[model samples]
Target: MENKQRLIGIVLAILGASFWGLGGTVSDYLFRHQNVDINWYVTARLLVSGLILLFIFKLLNPKLTIFSIFHNIQSTIQLFIFSIFGMLLVQYSYMASINYGNAAVATLLQYIAPVYIIIWFVLRKKANFKLFDLIAMLLTISGTFLLLTNGSTHNLVVPSSSVIWGIISGLSLAFYTIYASRLLVKFPAILVVGWAMIISGLLMNFKAPIWQFSITQLNFANVSYLTFGIIFGTAMAFFFFIKSLNYLSAKETTLFGTIEPVMAIVASAFWLKVSFLPYQSLGILLIIILILTLSLKKEQER
Candidate 1:
């Protein structure tokens, strides 16, 4: 039973990671070809995915009401902060990066969150910086330089704006990873995420109304990509990732989740015809290894 459960978790993790990776490719397609606005895309994905999650949660737990999170003032404030700074910022920054660059670069850039998290821990005096942490930081810096320069110090291969947005995405992710830990422990992932997403979408609608999109502007292909992003990428990906925690340790889950950037790079190179220099590829490998190392937990830490 234990082995079978672990196998199931592996499957879930793969599915979740692949779905998220492919979503980046879809974002690349939408931003490059379709006349899709980032605001509309973010708002729609959050609202629809959040509503679906709420529906599924209510279906699973008939006695637990979805409105329970709103009853607590502190929880409500936390949800608002999470929705605005964590969820909204993360989504907007990631999409903005993809809009300005290919999915491979944008995805890899966002993976720098682990490095940022380590920095935050060290700064807060919550963790003692060690040799492994030093190695990870060095790799992160060197890899980022190579990724941005693509082996040429003469010029940046990726746009500066894209790199900025990608860095913001990583920063937002790090904040969410640390801040949401307590909330996640206190509440179900679905409940917390559903409310946060819906709230974010609704709040953003005031400035960039999602209801203003014209139906004629959305053809079949455009609609299909958006549907895949919102359904498979946003909703199903979150579900599978959360479910994998039932059988896998946090380290195992993170190690598996690293597949997301690998798949994203592959999809971008093949589907979007993105090419990288030899040094850039080396940088990619180093960063991936760094992420894998980050997943390792020391005996004391664990």
Candidate 2:
């Protein structure tokens, strides 16, 4: 039974990675061809996904009302912060990066989340130092540098604003990862994610008003992609992630989740016909190894 559960968890993690990878790729296409503003796209995905999960909450746990969940002032404030910094900031910054840069470049930077997570863990005194952890951190930083430069030290060209936003987005992800994992210990993962999304969606609507666009300007060709992104990419992927967490240890699950960047690279290459330099490919490979090394526990060495 243990082995079976582990296998199931692995499968779910892979599936979640695939969906997220595809979503990243589709996001680029949506922005380029669909005439959708990054803010609007972010808002729509959050609202749609959040509303669906809210419905699920109502259907399955009608006894435990969302209103009741917010009765505690601390929880409410945490939820607000989670929604604002964790979801809104991360997603908006990511989408903005794609708009300012391209999907490949933006995604490569976003993968820096792992490195940030490592830093967060150490700073919070949640984890002690380990030789491999430091090595993994080095690899993560180096890989990000190579990926940023497209494997050429001379070609390291990024706008100042883009660099700031990318790093901010990367750092924000650490908060989201740690907070969500901790909150999962006390609250239903789905409920936390749903509320986070709803709050993020509402906040984004105000920050980047959808009133800027008209229905007539909407790009119909991109609707299908957006629909799939919200339903399968966002909602279903989150569900599978939570499900996998139930079976696997947090570190194990996170290590598997690194598959997202690899999947993104492959998807961008095939679907977008984007090509990377040899060094860039090597950097991406390095990132994969680094994440794998992080996931392997010390006891596994025995």
Candidate 3:
């Protein structure tokens, strides 16, 4: 029974990661080919996905009230902060990075969130500074330099805006990862995340209303990609990832989550015909190695 459960967890984790990675590629396609508006797309995606997640949670836990998070003043404040700074910022920055760069570069850059988390811990003195931590930092810096420069000091393979947005994506993700944990302990993941997304979506809609899209932007291909991103990529991906925690250890699930960036890189190259120079490829490999090293270190500590 345990073995079977583990197998199920592994499959769910892979599916979740695949959706996320491929979703980024889909967004890239829409941005580059369809010329979709990023603000409207992100707003609609968050709103729809959040509604779907909440609907599912309500079905599964009919007795639990979704509005309970707002019952407390402190939780309400934290939720608002997380909605804007953590969830909204991460989504907008990631999509902006993809718009300015290819999905592969954007995804890999976001993978540096773990490095940011480590730095945050060290700065706060919450974690002991170790030799491996320094090595990880160096590896991250070297890999980022190569990725941006592609082995040349004079030329940049990706735009400066892409790099900036990608770094913000990583920082926001680190913030989300740390802050979400506290909310998750008191409320269920679905409740907290769903509420966060809806709040963020509503906030974003103030800047670019989701209902104001032109009819020309509602073509079959654009609609299909947006649907896929909202349903499979956002809602189902979050669902599967959270479900996998029941059967697998957090470390094992995290290790499997690495498949996301790999899938993004592969899908971008094959589907989008995005290419990377040899030095950039090497840089990607180093970042992958860094992720594995950190995951292993965590496993060892456990």
Model 1 ranges off by over 4 Å: 299-302
Candidates 1 and 3: which is better by TM-score? 3
lDDT of 2 by residue, 107-182 (tens): 6677777677767767779777678678878898787777667666676655545666778888888788777655
| Tens digit of per-residue lDDT, candidate 1, span 110-194 | 9989788888889889888888779989999999899889778799988999999999999999888788876887789999998
- Which candidate, 2 or 3, would have the higher lDDT against the true structure? 3
Q: What digit string (tens of lDDT, one per residue) describes model 3 on residues 1-302?
A: 98999999999998998999999999999999998899988998889888998998999999988899999999999999999999999999999999999888889899999888888889999888889889999999999888889999997989999999999999999999999887988999988999999999999999889898899767899889988887898889999998899899888888888988999999999999998899899899999899888777753541
- Compared with the true structure, model 3 gives a TM-score of 0.97
Error of 3 at 164 (Å): 0.4
What's each prediction's TM-score? 0.96, 0.88, 0.97
lDDT of each: 0.88, 0.77, 0.90
Clashing pairs in 2: none
- Ranking of all candidate structures by their TM-score, best first: 3, 1, 2
Worst 10 residues of 1 by lDDT: 293-302
The 10-residue segment of model 2 with minimum total lDDT is: 293-302
Q: Largest TM-score belongs to which candidate? A: 3
